[model samples]
Target: MENSTQINTEKINFSLEDLEQDIWVRLVTGAVKSRNPFHTPCVATMDKGEISLRTVVLRKALAKERELRFHTDIRSPKWKELSLNPSISALFYDAGDRIQLRVKGKAVLHYKNDLTAEAWKNTTSSSRRCYLTLHSPSSFAEIPTSGLSEEIEQENFTLAESEMGYSNFGIVSIQVHSIDWLWLNHAGHRRAFFDYTDGSFQWMIP
Candidate 1:
């Protein structure tokens, strides 16, 4: 779920590497990057004074790059919104650990780029083919179209429609401006933020 970035404007700063690392622990302990594929951070935007968030998967962990990324269909509603307003927030929680993290930043979209294509190529044909079925993600239909339904050839459809769908397959990169982390430990609850926009971090009262 990582996207490549060409312009290096800013890198997100964390208050402390240990706490930041601990948050990662909370994520792993909660199987955040694994089974929680759909537990992706909710990207929110202020749509005419109201807020809306959508589920998105964290596809890649570019820690070294100091970045976080996710993947979604380019035609998805969230994608279109981001296209209009790059500023967005990603929210995640680990129920077992009683921890949550929110990152706010500008979003960039990558589709069919060298890196994106590489990831797409590495994906399983079964999953890769799913993108071929439709252009509009989250679009509703009167009925479901399963690979096993209608005695139709799913593989053939994917292969035949690959080009058309590939254009819409995209990865989203969050240009993290700040990260607000809330964690509960043996001592007490702690909330802190790493603000890259100002190049400083502070621990906040939780």
Candidate 2:
């Protein structure tokens, strides 16, 4: 049996403006509900003149501000990379929709600030446990582990336990500069570029 079902593109047709709205709505809803794979995007940044990429869960999407939000451990290498160079790109794909969105933006890190506090307040205890690791992310160790100690096991985890992770929790807010949208179909692929800096939206050759 086929593992996936293909989307029929024949019934899908929209103007650039409509498509943009659709994309934003889908992204915002996906992030809020964590309902689709688009909720996790491949975020790319520059580290020591080299490109670094990682998948991050989307925490928020502000369509009006053209911004995307994600949380990370402050000790992660990506946090350091973003601190050194805020310019970043995120790629999101919806296989069911045959849509791909590439977002270019500048990231602003929030730590021990109002933004971080608010984000933490909204975070679930289970989710917050990720930041409770004793070692920094990607750290070398003799044995493999989740980095969380036995004392922090899931069964007894609580919101109070998350306080220990506050120092390591950080939020990344990306101010979107541009978005390249592509839709693939058996008939033809459609591509469009949206530049928020210049308020330009134009079709591009796929």
Question: Model 2, 1-206: lDDT tens per residue?
Answer: 11122233575566778777877887787687666867899999999899999999999998898989999999999999999999999999988777899999999998999989988888886787788888898999888788887767563676776798999999999999999999998888989999999999999998
TM-score of each: 0.75, 0.91
Error of 2 at 102 (Å): 0.5
State each model's CA lDDT, in order: 0.65, 0.86
Candidate 1 local lDDT, residue 159: 51
Candidate 1 regions with alpha-carbon error over 4 angstroms: 1-15, 24-33, 36-39, 144-164
Best by TM-score: 2
Give every collision pair in model 2. none
Model 2 TM-score (2 dp): 0.91
RMSD of 1: 7.5
lDDT of 2 at 165: 90
